[model samples]
Target: MNETRERIALLSKALDLMTDRPIRVMEVCGTHTVSIFRQGLRSLFPPSLELVSGPGCPVCVTDQGEIDAAVSLAGIKGVTVATYGDMLRVPGSGSSLVNERALGRDVRVITSADQALEIARNEKTRLVVFVAVGFETTAPSTASVILDAHREGRGNFTVLNLHKAVPPVLEALASDKNIALDALLLPGHVSVILGLSPYRFLPEDHGIACAVAGFGAEDIMLALVEVVRQIREGRPRVASLYSQAVREEGNCLARDLIDRVFEPCDSSWRGLGNLPLSGYGLREEYSSIDALKRLEISINDTSPPSGCSCGEVLKGKMLPRECALFGRLCNPSHPVGPCMVSSEGSCAAHFRFSRGGDHPWKH
Candidate 1:
């Protein structure tokens, strides 16, 4: 703990020495968002350095159309929808998975994709659709499960593939002139799958500094220090501070598995529109188990709630509290938007940890 404090102090000093101008560093991982709030890292930073949350939470960033499709699929007879618990309460056009489940739809909250496969294997009469939603960190596990189901001949098993790639979204954000971002605190978990090579575009193409950081206070502090140092020294590059788990080349086996099962395709994010080659879809070989293809479900684009600013929040253009419905009508109990529904969501994190201060930097 003492060493961690020392590192934090050093990071504070580095922030002071870095520049007088305000620097906005976005952390594009939900775990990193929660870690920053849980460890009170925001209070430790100088006012010049602001930490903004991006569209990091997969459940939070999932398009309303996709959620509506999943909800619609759940209402179909002989179909059992399986997904992580976080996706249950996300409001779609008219209903959520939770709402459908209460209406007697078979919605199963699963821990792994394999559990959904098992359900399909045992319940041969029912169709099990695993709502796969995540970045590259979790995609490999889903890929592995798909391979297992294909080998075992689980005909009833399929996945609503909402798996997104991080690098392309980051590139989209970097290229956008509206968001004034100085550096990015890359996701350590995703970096473990993609390694350092994928993030090179941030610095090489966009002139942004990046650091792949772990979830610890010390790790985040060290990453911030490195980012500040790079900016101060005029050297923008992608550096990995989570060296214990991440490598330059990343996990080749995991990459190969993902490539074998899934292919890059255009994907729609909640706030960010359809990004080219930003999502993973089941390849031709895996079409037998692809739910979107087999079920022929029609997805309609749905708008967010009337007063919710979750889209702006996801894009880092607006803070959670800045939304009119943040705490008044958008608390955890009755969430009006995905940002409030997700545990790793910026609104949820701010509501739980930073609500007292109205503005985080002011505190």
Candidate 2:
């Protein structure tokens, strides 16, 4: 604990001494946002260094239209919808998967893609549809399971592929002039898969400094220190602070699995609209197990909730407190938006740690 304080003090001093102009850095991973709040790192930052949460939470960034489609899929006869637990309570156009389950629709929360396949193998009478959602880290696992189902000839198994790529969205964020970003704290897990190559464009094209960081407090701080240095010296580039896990090339076998099973398609994000080649669709060869193809459910656009500012929050345009519905109408229990419902959501983290209490890291 004493060591932690010394490290924090050193990094804090480094930031205070180096930072002159106001620097806006976005932590572009939901896990990073949660870790920052949980470790009380918010109180330790210098006033010139501002950290904002990006659309890093996979569940939070899922467009409302996709949620609605999942709900629609759940309502089908002889269909069982399986997805990660985080996706259960997210509100769609009219209802969520949990609500559909309450109404006797077969909506099951699963921890792994294999569980969905298991359900398909066991429940021969019912068609099990896995709601595949996540970035590259989880995509390879989903692809692996899709192959398992196909190899085992589990014809009742299909996937509502909502998997998204991080780089395309990062490119979109970098190009958006409305949200000024001096630097970005890139996602650790996603970087472990994508490596450093995909992020070169951010610095090369947009002139933004970025660093990949793990979920630990010190890991995040060290990454910030790198960001501060880049800003101070005006040499913006991509740096990986969490070199223990992330590699320059990333995992090749996983990438090969993703390529074999899925292909890039236009995907819609909640805050950011349809980004070209931002999402993964099961390849044409895998159409036999594609949920949308089998179920014939189209992902039509839907308007977000009237007062929820989740989109703005995701884009770093607004903080959680800036939204009127944040605490009033959108607490975790009664989430009016996906940002509040998701565990990695910026609003949820703020509500849990930043509400009415004394600052956690003051000591």
Candidate 3:
């Protein structure tokens, strides 16, 4: 514990030394956002350095159209929708999975993709559709389960693949002029799977300093220090500070599993609209278990609530507190948006940990 504090103090001093000017850094992982706030790391940064949250929460980023589609899927007769628990309360155009479940629709919260497959194996008469939503970190597990279902001839098993690739979305964010980010604290979990190769574009193409960081205070501080150091040196590049978990080459086996079962496709985000080649679709070989193909479900684009600024929050354009609905009409108990509904969401994290404003340490 003492060593962690000393390391953080050194990193904080390093950050203070390098941050001569205002630097806006976005932590592109929901877990990072929560960790920053939970550990009071937001207060440790230099006054010139600002940390913002990005579209890192999978539940928060799952488009309203996709949510509505999943809700619609749940209402279908003989169809059982299996999804992560965080997705249960995310509002759709009209209803959520939880609401549908209450309305007698068979929507079940699953801890793993394999559970959905097991449900399919047990209930042969019913169609079991797993709503797969995550970044590259979780996609390999979902892919593995899909393959298992295919091999076991679980004809009733299918997956609504809302799994998104992180690189394309990061490219989109890097190109956006409005954000004008100086650096990025990359997701450690996703980086463990993708390695450092996929993120080279951030520094090479956009001139943004980025570093892969873990959830711990020391790990995040090390990454932040590296980012500030890169900025100070005028040599913006991608660095892996969380080398214990992340590698330069990433996990080849996991990538192989993802590639074997899924193909790149255009995907829509909550705020970022449709990004090219940003989502994963099951490959032709896995069409038998592709929920959209097998179930013939249509997904129509839907807008957010009238007063919710969840989209702005997801894009790092607006803070969670800036939204009028935050902590007022939209608490975790009665969420007005996905950002409030999701545990890893920026709004939820802010609501739980933040006292008033951006400066949590002050309060």
Candidate 4:
């Protein structure tokens, strides 16, 4: 048989080997979340195997106060906002960055944090503010830009520090007994930066097998197979199925840059409450450029639209439909929370495919 057929056969065999009649595994990456839904992968897999999404999408999990802060910053004269393509659409207190952009405000889309520094250096009149988002995968890049800005003396450039660490969030999830995940399909993007060295601690320390897997349909299927296989064979360990990107030591330069630019700070997740040392803050020397340090804004913490269960969804506790606004009121166009706004969010994926229909299996 061909390689494709061989892979499928392996997956089928792996599923058959699962102990205690199948298991539940979570894809902790947002890209994986969207890809799984878009490819209609669930219908292809056995009903016994389940794939639940986690807080892999940074934009989706970013607290509502952050969205509001970004919109509030948008109105400041001579302040230029730079962010990934994802944050442009997320609504903040009835207004998204895009809505603010419609009123002729300055909002720039940047691939790397260095690009924002370049703009800040050249445009002396504009205060270049990078809307820093993402987990370990994207955080290193932001760290690189911050170090470069400080080294080059680019004072006009500052980041709205919303960067988060991966492992702590994982710990928070694992500590919660309610999750009951048999194994975890770790994020590929974050693994590319941080590598599998630190993740060895997950299995050794947390007693959970973390398979660093790719985001494609076939990649995820293979990961699920391996995860199930490990449990059945009575072997729990951290392994990399997507060796093309992930390594043991990870990217050293990226890690060094992240270390130099920022320090660990207490971070609050949308679903999981405040996690100690889960977020990043600008270092003391770089504090001059940090917007949070520069401008003081009164942030009022409010519940997400009363019954909106976006937080619970981020934690994988509830499905998208569990929320009253899932399809009726909350959607890509008119999002009640960040989950609906972000393309990688679980709610967006379910709304896009699972809506006007039902899942083939009973969860």
Clashes of each: 0, 0, 0, 0
lDDT string, candidate 3, 1-363, tens digits: 666677777888888887899999999898898888888888888898989999999999899899998998998899999999999999888898999999999999999988999999999999999999999999999999988988888899999999999999889988999999999999989999999989998999999999998788888888888898899899999987888889899999999999999999999999889999999988999988887888798778888888989999998999999999888799999998998988899999999988845643333
Query: What 10-residue stretch in candidate 3 is worst by lDDT?
Result: 354-363
Model 1, residue 294: C-alpha shift (Å): 2.0
For candidate 1, give the lDDT. Answer: 0.90
Best by lDDT: 2
Against the true structure, what is each candidate's TM-score? 0.96, 0.98, 0.96, 0.92
Candidate 2 vs candidate 3, TM-score winner? 2
Task: Tell me how many residue pairs clash in candidate 3.
Answer: 0
Query: Model 4's lDDT to the true fold?
Result: 0.81
lDDT rank order: 2, 3, 1, 4
* lDDT (10s digit) by residue, model 4, range 211-311: 98887667877887777777777787987988988887788888887888889998878878779999987789888778876666534564556667888
lDDT of each: 0.90, 0.92, 0.90, 0.81
Worst 10 residues of 4 by lDDT: 354-363
Kindly list the per-residue Cα lDDT of model 1 for residues 1-363, writing each as its tens digit. Answer: 566566677776776776577888999999999999977778878788888999999999899899999998998899999999999999988999999999999999999887988899899999999999999989999999999999998899999989999999999999988898899999989999999988898988888989999998778888888888788787999988898999899999999999999999999998898999999988999998888788999667888778888889998999999898989899999999998998999999998898545432222
User: Candidate 1 at residue 16, lDDT?
Assistant: 70
Model 4, C-alpha of 229: deviation from truth (Å): 1.2
lDDT of 3: 0.90
